[model samples]
Target chain A: MDTKTLCDGILDGQRRALSKAITLVESARADHRVQAAALLEALKAAQASPREALRIGLSGTPGVGKSTFIESFGMALVREGLKVAVLAVDPSSARSGGSILGDKTRMELLSREAGAFIRPSPSQTELGGVARRTREAVALCEAAGFDVVLIETVGVGQSETVVSEMSDLFVLLLAPAGGDELQGVKRGIMEMADLILVNKADGDLKAAANRTRADYAAALRLLRKRPQDPDGFPKALAISALQEDGLAQAWAEMGTLADWRRAQGHWARTRANQNRHWFMEELRLALLAQLTQAGPVRDAVARLGDSVASGTTTPALAVQSALALLHP
Target chain B: MDTKTLCDGILDGQRRALSKAITLVESARADHRVQAAALLEALKAAQASPREALRIGLSGTPGVGKSTFIESFGMALVREGLKVAVLAVDPSSARSGGSILGDKTRMELLSREAGAFIRPSPSQTELGGVARRTREAVALCEAAGFDVVLIETVGVGQSETVVSEMSDLFVLLLAPAGGDELQGVKRGIMEMADLILVNKADGDLKAAANRTRADYAAALRLLRKRPQDPDGFPKALAISALQEDGLAQAWAEMGTLADWRRAQGHWARTRANQNRHWFMEELRLALLAQLTQAGPVRDAVARLGDSVASGTTTPALAVQSALALLHP
Candidate 1:
């Protein structure tokens, strides 16, 4: 289908069209890139106003029940007549033995709901490219009338932080444990989380989950909260996806946080800053792409890099020489 | 006067020529930049290989006795027949009600010694420029036959972190403190520190210093050691700058760490990486300078930025438009 037809179908909330459009954006083909950029330009013009969707970033370790929690939480949102969409960017998905977001089997109930849409993470080599595409996917989903977009990232490496950049609210999922587990958590991720959820808070693990929540809460209190966070610091709570317990409370808190952010001017400001941040990043990436594609520039850079590595040429001079080559 | 003459004096370890050359590097005048680059190029060829210098980055909070510790440390190194040069980058020097390196008062004895050379932090507005100049200053010092370069950064803001980028060893100094104080420390900086020292261990603070030392030692144990770290994890020690206690041990440890890094070949690899990193950073800065200085590009960026802020244009599109303005 053409760009107009696909965009119209997306605006009409057609899942298949939205999926196809995402595929176009994710495609690495030169011709497809041109078409994808044109489609995005059209989409931007179609929706001149700011989007109202709540973009929530979900992150957790491999077995932290992220999929289950997201499934339950997604069902709750869909039950409220709110459309929900899930997109992931898991760089390690190939090594971890699955297509990115191949957990459609686990999200079975939500998958059956018409209001719910699940798109697996694209199996892309470049993390930045994948993240850019995922962000564009969020915009398309919003255009398709999805009021709640959940982005689940395998929170181990650099991708988790990138996911947070595109999110309105960042939620970190953790399993209940004592001792070393707390220390094992990356301090960097903890600082980025807007909310922490201790999943699997059912039966025998209930009390342990509560204790874990308290410990994280205390740890967070010690942290200097992000200036953009709402009045209170990051809050921690417990939930059980197996029993579908506390799912309502979790969903309610998400709404409350979103509302608070929107009511204050922070929501708008944050989005604007995000746009500028991405603009600079995209510029850098594009420049790098250009440099690598140009034969003479590429050869010079490699030779200069080797000289730099051997300490024969200073980096400043090397960059100057490379820039000279570019202009010449 | 001439670049060639300046190079000769610098290679001959003339302090006057070295100071003049650093001033040239720090100058914002266009002609000076050209001359500075030429001088650096000449020096690079004059010295066929990378010089071996022990670069130590020392950081501490305002009242944590950083100056006192450095003075004692510098004097001890001088007594050991080592030629020492100290450079600093303090962003808060003005608000802290002092000149950059105001501790020159406390360092009077060391200042009088012919073996020691001290350069105060330049009052540059941009932190990156200051850092760049400081890195160049280190090379100049080495060219002047200074074997030990101690970079003392006011640990309040971003300068401390930048200082770490240019150094072979990063030492974080903290005063005697309780659990709360440890929690108050920035986790990111803690991760970067190669060694942690609890200073001011004289008089009644001795017991508290030891306790703080043990606490930090345990905390450091919890952190994953950097792959570049020579052997064990970051070690914590207690020292008294007032009484000159533990000064010898601290100085000895610096040598041990530097030797370990060099023997493992990490020293050369790290310097290469740093050179590359700075090269990229310099390119970005130079590009930004050009973009802003060009009237059409600057105006276009401002207009696009305003549109992006109002949510009318996406960051990707804005960047593309700006890039077009560049080429056109």
Candidate 2:
């Protein structure tokens, strides 16, 4: 099928385009980029038909079996007849400016499941594995009638909090370890996770996991509750992702939090804030692309850069001069 | 003094006015922001002056003796007649939007020193404890003839990298303990630091500290070196903030990094990049504030939020709709 028809099929919720479209959108070939943008715009319009769908963000350190857990959790929801869409985020090449697309391997089960559509998207050198295309991919998913869209960011991307701006519920997965686990995360991360799950709680580690949970719970009490998670209740939980134990219970807990938020009308306000944030991010990125990629200022930027390095011009002077040339 | 005169004094290298100007800039008074902007504009025009100063950013985890070490370090620099200026980045108040300004108390000795100028500026609800106004404070310090400027951020703020963005050198202080320390900090952060100082390394923990230094040195081999610390070297040292052992050496190492970076032309490049980044950040933030704080669209944004929470409208749709209202 042609690009237009592919996009139409995607809009009509045809499962094939849902898979193919992600690949196309993630492609870097010049023609593919053009087609991807067209498809992405169509997907955006389709999702925009009534309103947008809920975008959920999932993140944790790598090797925590994020894929297996996602598969199980997603399958469970699919069995309940909900159209679950998973947009798995992965790291990219800094020099080549492309993605390895390695997540599809880990998410083999979910990728093969019919009711659960999983798209492992590459981050492509963006700050967070969650990229501009990732946001667009999410639009395509919702337009395709998927109810739940999960975005998984790269494990090592610390400064990439941009997902918070895209997601409705931010769920963090943690490997249940000892008290030392707390030291792994920065306080900023601890403050961001709406629900913290201690994954891999199956064997002899179960007791250690529980102790870790208790320690985190105690440590959490010292932190003022995030106003965003204002249920006035602790939101941390322990689950064995491998055993799939507590998976259903965790989903139910997520529902409860969603209900509490809606009843309190905080969800709307939160999304509104998130939208404003995305708009700014888009502008920042677009401007950066334009400024960095422009033909006219590139040489000047490079030259001024050399002068600044040589101390022939100070930073303030260099910037003043560079922007002047770019803007002029 | 009148705001204009106060700003002039700063530009004229009057020490008193620089402090007064920083206080005025940090004030959220109705007129203070406008006054600060004016002062900044005036200072910007006086760009011809090049003061021999090094901007150093110091960060580490909480209990890493960040405050205590800064006190000892700042005092040492001043004793050398360097005319040190420290802008202690305080954590922002998430709710009240007030500043705690605790740096002075934490650095009682340094604050009371004859030639040392220590200013505890509130971060005011930023992800990093470094306040938006901290840059202004730095500029004011430069204008006031301070030869060395130190910016201190709370380790818990998770914005060590943000503070790292503004300075000539990034000094990451780590406490000596915890077998998990290497794994705790991802390669991204370790790669960003120019120098890693193991604090509280005096006496009992010296051996453990040495092990950590060895482990980190081994680990850093896998990553690209920060240009300022060539030989792919991340200077590792042990210091007891309490005893102030190795304090002078730490300062000397920092000075060496600055000199080397300056020689490599990296110092100017770094500052120029920081300036360009500020411009980019300002452009994005200005637009964000304008959109969210707009009068008509604010309520419409609040209204469209409902469809998003009920899962009736996806976040992307709500955003597009909000933008329609905002732009229309």
Best by TM-score: 1
Q: Candidate 1, TM-score vs. the true structure?
A: 0.71
Candidate 2, residues A278-310, lDDT tens digits: the string is: 544543443344345647666676676665444
Computed on C-alphas against the true complex, the DockQ of each candidate is 0.29, 0.11
lDDT of 1 at A72: 88
Query: Could you estimate the TM-score for every candidate?
Result: 0.71, 0.66
| Candidate 2 segments whose C-alpha is farther than 4 A from its true place | A1-8, A16-86, A91-116, A122-328, B1-4, B27-38, B44-48, B60-80, B92-101, B127-131, B171-226, B230-264, B294-328
Q: Give the Cα error of residue A263 in candidate 1, in Å.
A: 8.3
- Model 2 clash count equals 6
* Cα lDDT listed for each candidate: 0.81, 0.67
What tens digits encode model 1's per-residue C-alpha lDDT throughout A1-328? 8999998888888999999999998876646766776777787788757456899999988788988898889998999999999999787665666855466887999989999999988877688788878988998898898999999997677888889889999999999988246635588888888899999899999999999988888878777677667665588888898898888888888778888878888888888887776766666566656555647767777788878767777766776787677555
Give the chain A TM-score for each candidate: 0.89, 0.81
Show the lowest summed lDDT stretch of 10 residues, model 1 chain A.
A285-294
Residues B172-288 of candidate 2 have per-residue lDDT tens digits of 888887545563554556777888888887688878877776666666666555546667467777787888889888887777777777789887767767765654454334334
Compute the DockQ of candidate 1: 0.29
